[model samples]
Target: MNTVGVRGYSLELRTRIVALVLGGASPGEAAKHFSVHVDTVKSYLKRHHQNTLHIVAKPTGRRRTVMALHEQQLLAQLETHQDATLQEHADMLETITGLKISYKTVDRVFRRYKITHKKNTGRQRTP
Candidate 1:
């Protein structure tokens, strides 16, 4: 059984597998023919059986902070307070929005926005 990428199967392939099961192909048969795990075929068939088959399954996770309602305000705060450390940024966000967040969250937001505030690590020339 081939499990190539992270999600294992592409959306188009998943849809096709589900369609095959619906068209009276046994899940195991479909799995062998497609070189996919039988369990994976069963999962697709389950969605088909439950009438919840989607060509593109809705993403299943928390939405990104960058897409939050307060994203613009957060970006502006980051821009205006360029020298603030990650902890400071988190505290500032808490103060302004009453939403306390971790320094890691601040770091992740900075990374997502391509904002760089890291101190230079190279040694300076002696005077």
Candidate 2:
């Protein structure tokens, strides 16, 4: 049997799998319907049943700070002025918004936006 790519599976496929499992459809039947292996269907059912026991919500990956559009514009300005240090950026943001943000926070935002401290030249330098 060919291994199914999880990325290629859609929401509809997930719903179908859940419905088939809950409706007491055999693993083989469910697998045929989903175009996956019988073992895959059984595994999904087992996982679904296990998850239903505890029902605790899973924690999402790191959340980003919610910055306003104007704040983003200010960030752009800071990026253009590469000479400005992290402390300077933080101070400027605080002065404008009356919200004191740490230099680390400013640095993280810069990294997330791919705005490096040093601008890259088109020419590549050899070692």
Pick the TM-score winner: 1
- Write down the TM-score for model 1: 0.57
- Could you give candidate 2's per-residue lDDT for residues 61-126 as a string of tens digits? 665553765359557757576577778888877777776878788877778878656534843322
RMSD list, candidates in order: 5.6, 7.1
**Residue pairs in collision within model 1:** none
* Predictions in order: lDDT: 0.74, 0.67
lDDT of 1: 0.74
Can you give the lDDT of residue 67 in candidate 2?
70
Count of backbone clashes, every candidate in sequence: 0, 0
Off by over 4 Å in 2: 1-11, 16-43, 47-63, 79-81, 119-127
Give the per-residue lDDT of model 1 (tens digit) for 1-127: 4447534577788889988887899988998888889888998888777876564455567866544745566687877876667788788888888887788887787777786665655633222
